[model samples]
Target: MSSFDLTEDQQDCLQELINVAMGQASDQLARYLDTFVYLKVPSIEQVKSEHLFETLNQDLKATAVVSQGFFGYEGIRGEALLMYQPQDSHRLADLLGYEADELTFDEQIIDLSSILTTTFLNVFASQIDNQMSYSAPRLLSANQGTISEHLNQQSFNWDLALKVRISYQVTDYSFNCDMVLLIPEEAINNIKAVIDRILEDF
Candidate 1:
């Protein structure tokens, strides 16, 4: 039971919208990994920038990171961060027959990440966009140290942002992926508007 600037209806809409986005991600993952992929009922949260790692530390420590962003028609909107356990990501890479070195700069690797980003966010943004018409999202990320430092150095407006946690599970495997969805504080009102729209649709 946590308090948020968003109303209960907003939260529910966010959940439903994420469900659709997760489905899109799973579809892309299944095709890309050449294995069946499924997702759990994703969990959402709102937290400060400094507490990000602490909030998701337990779920993130074991995973290799794969993240991107979600933009809407209005412009740069929110971000999407995905983390897969090392073993699982390694298995996925191997399943795709990618060598260790190939994972970083290979054409397939680049295309895969891009495709995942485009597909996942396009659907996600669209769902939320239907309500508030968010601007298009641009994906961003780097290695663990870089990502951590980048966020740490930035000045954040806490009042306007929210953190959405989306967890994924493979239908035929024991692997799990946790996705962190974040929107800046200034965009919080827009996000809530999208959530409200979703709730109305329901």
Candidate 2:
């Protein structure tokens, strides 16, 4: 069995690949909202399941969370957590020219999560020559407790997970969200193999 570790070089390659995918996702978001979307550099790390909430708490405080599960060829599978602050819904709805009613607010949250998760994962999977499928984006929490609180309430089966942290912000608007992609331990070897192949081709 392959050790559950990513070397420095592998980590760099993965981060670069994620950066490209995130750039594409940002472009799609910009087109959807007709506004400039600023993207922070994405960070990747291995985190134990027990410490997931602590890692999330260090990032941002979130009041809303959308969860989407994705699977890819070669055992690459995980869940993506899209978290937003309380004010994000109102700001996003305003950008979309919506009145921010209950119905529209929920719709906008799902819509944004779908766009970000699908676009980003599709591009990333393509780089690894993998086909991807996703579950419907479900709103897990809204106006709830802190991000850590909501995250702790869920159950994670893996002992360790590869966490890819991504953030998006819109200039001139107080709108921002954090996305955490958690890849379970079972898929680490498969991902490392793919990365190794890509490194060889270079």
List model 1 lDDT by residue over 89-117, tens digit each. Answer: 43444555577566553333334445555
TM-score of 2: 0.90
lDDT of 2 at 9: 90
Pairs clashing in candidate 2? none
- Give candidate 1's error at residue 73 in angstroms: 1.6
Error of 1 at 49 (Å): 2.4
Cα lDDT of model 2 by residue, 1-202, tens digit: 2378898899899988998887887787788778888779988889988888888877465578899999999889999998888766677767765667845677788878887888889988887889799999998878678877776777877798899989888876778888889998888888998899899999
Give residue 142's error in model 2 in angstroms: 0.8
| Highest lDDT against the true fold, candidate | 2
For TM-score, the strongest prediction is: 2
TM-score of 1: 0.68
Off by over 4 Å in 2: 59-62, 96-102
